[model samples]
Target: MTIQLPTEIWWRILDYLPSNKVKQLGRVNRAFLEKARQSRYQSLVIYEYDKKTKRRLKKIRSSSLGHYVRSLTLCVQAWPASDLIRWDGQTGDSLSVVDRVRSLFDSHYLPRKTVALKKKRLDRRIELIFEAMTAFEHIQEYELIWEEYDQDCPEEFIPEVKFASSLMTIFLSMLVISPLRGTLTKLSLQIPTHIALDCLAAADFPFLEDLKVFLWKSQCSRAKDWDILTGYLGSENLAKFISGLSSTLQTLSISRLDPSINLDRDFGRVFDLLCRTNFPFLRSFDFCTRSRYLRKGTPSLDRFVRQISHSVRSLKLSHLAYDTSSSSPLHHLDHRSWISNVLSVQGLQTRAFSSLTSLRIKDGSLSAHLADLSALLTSVAHQLVSFFLEDNLLTLKEVETVVCSLSHSSSPLRYLGIEPRDLAPDTFDLLVCAFPGLRELSLSFERFTSSDDDVIPMTEEDVRCMFPNLCLDLGFFCFGLMNTAGATADGIICLRLRSAVSLEIELCLMR
Candidate 1:
């Protein structure tokens, strides 16, 4: 007798099985085949295109398997000469991609014969990508990553193909017009230059919920020299595009690797516009810049933060700080007021960020003003479940101030990560007791003493006293298992510390 399970039961059981085991069960019946199709076709990532991939995509397009795909990631890397060989002998749909590509180039008056041989090759790959994308119908998430070797590549290596900025813009414009656009909810574009942003500003993403734009250079572009990129900073286009999506967008993350653009003038304008727009559904907003000083847009930044404070659950403001040393003494006198101007709203200091639970403040000169930092932390302590202050190492006294500020909160925090300029024996006890419900803790100390061996003697006894079962491994001590189940079992504790050269400790516990 054979066991017969309901379809839902079979689905639940298959979800728990590994891919290889699921494949074995897939051959049993049509139901198993359906589950296997979903498991295999739901997410697809193609790094490079070739004869094999072309053939596989053709099969998927002609069958029902394409409909099962919900996510796709296509990495466009520097095309090797072999991958872009002319389609001289191929026929049928191969010729169609060539014709469509040639027509697109012709529209710009870029005659295929006059263009560089490598460019013509690049054109073929771009067209092939377009054709390959038509296979999926229900894609809800799509990531288009332009992967190129940087200047750090070995001198012996030579990049054969060089693509123009306009080509990328054209490709992106066409990509958004696909049939799957209406169904897309998450979109990530990793491209180079503000030209792409300008081109995509007009495209509509009615259902888009999450948008991430990462601007960097491709292999064809030179490194550290952003002067090659033409066109204005697309601030107006970006503001317009984001405003259009405000009704449905829930998460927005924007990052730029190019450091030449002035944050005060470019990003400040963007934030100034964002301050006025209302995002009823927005829950997370992350903006990162490489600027060392934020001289302008303090008022706009404060308003923007306060505008979303009530709705956003996770907030990150990275590398946004003023440089006191760069300013004259007269201007330096206003440092505390400046920090307040950027952090708090006009009349809602305590009520700001009422819904925010996760906050990350990273890489800046914020530690210079201890009082303002303490006040900001104290105000949000009761609501934040995960708070991380990275790259801003506080002194031992400053760390005590932070702990004391957060100690007033009634809610228990689950994760806390911070760095201290120095570490004392009592530091561990202070942190562990400060947040009794902390499940994970990260502490990095810049120095233990003048000598490197000072760290071992400082932490060894304290760690041993706290958890005797911690096993020593390669100068670091660890206790309990690393998995979540083991973390909850037997009230186990895991602690690891390094030497004074760079003393670091990571501890995790339950209850």
Candidate 2:
């Protein structure tokens, strides 16, 4: 007798089984094995530490698991000696402990773990990890996280290691050599600049639609190396890379470049390359930096904005504060103005983005520049559905002006986020009125003051008075007074109206 079931039912049952278990069931018979092989698994996670209890994973020949995988996360834990301090006066030698761990890792024959380095050995360890990653044939998304190790007096035996930086270079090298380019949809290189450039030059991910490159502060101090780094990312090379990318690449994010390094010429060249390139599918753009403005005017910023004006649908601008001194009022204002000018110009462009639906501005104020920003918002508000402004300096009145501009338009905007100071009563009402289709709203209120009668009851009259168009998804956080009756009730009604809408209410009670 044989068990006969519908194919759909079998697939549904198989979905309930773990990958390892599915593999086990596959070995039970040929039918099970074929079904298991056909299953489309979406995520693959490879960790540095081996599980204490090891179970045998099915070894299938000639079958690549890459096609089914959508996302990949790699976590590498470098030995931390300081974490192993004993309560007694006697302290464990950090290097000796690391050596013991390395020895145990060496015992394993796994490809990624095969290259276990001796204590204080950095280069060899990185090599081994790269060798192991070569087996992954198709990878759509990749994440690399390297833990830092402490350098205490007792741990002097451990070499002053830049392990993360070295590891990044090796990973980039693998991307160049790997045949996974065509299938690679998203590539995130969280490494230093040199390695990122090297990887960019090595392979062309024709299907690469999204790219995020993170450059950390490198201790390497040679003018020649810096020149080489920039040289690799020159206009010609960038053009070649984009051209080879099957014309599918869209979103690009570069982080943490040296602030002192003048980005005007380089960014201009990049903008030219992108403008010349045909990105029919490009829709979103994000530019973030920790560097300060070396020159007074932000030509690079303006040029970059102009280049992408026609295509960008979703945009995010973030500036990282390097130090307290670097956070001077003048410098901060300069950065804000540069960003504002770009937004204003882009908004005014005749060939505006028709597909833009979402916009986010972070860590800077858009108030002083709201008039310019309002022009941009008015241009795209018709198609815009979500807008987020976090940690920006804006007064209640300014926020209302922008919201009023957006509301007047016949746009589909349903979600709005603003900083704490911008959430005044009048401004809140204005936002609710403007985005009639609004399903989600987030407010960061700096101070919420109320007189003696804080918790006022809401009648039908009040509801109509507050919001004539009552349908919305409300998320509110008040930094001052917690007692606001109608606010909470209105929030509940908004949540109940739309199943898709999410509401969050936080009241900061006054002391």
lDDT of each: 0.63, 0.55
Candidate with maximal TM-score:
1
Clashing pairs in 2: 206-245, 407-434, 420-444, 420-446, 439-473
In model 1, what is the error at residue 193, expressed in angstroms?
A: 1.3
Give every collision pair in model 1.
none
Per-residue C-alpha lDDT of model 1 across residues 405-424, encoded as one tens digit per residue: 77744656666778876444
The alpha-carbon deviation from the true structure for residue 417 of candidate 1, after best TM-score superposition, in angstroms, is: 0.5
**CA RMSD per model (angstroms):** 9.2, 8.3
Candidate 2 — number of clashing residue pairs? Answer: 5
Model 1: residues >4 Å from true position, as ranges? 1-36, 78-127, 152-164, 217-231, 291-299, 320-341, 344-348, 448-511
In TM-score terms, candidate 2 sits at 0.68
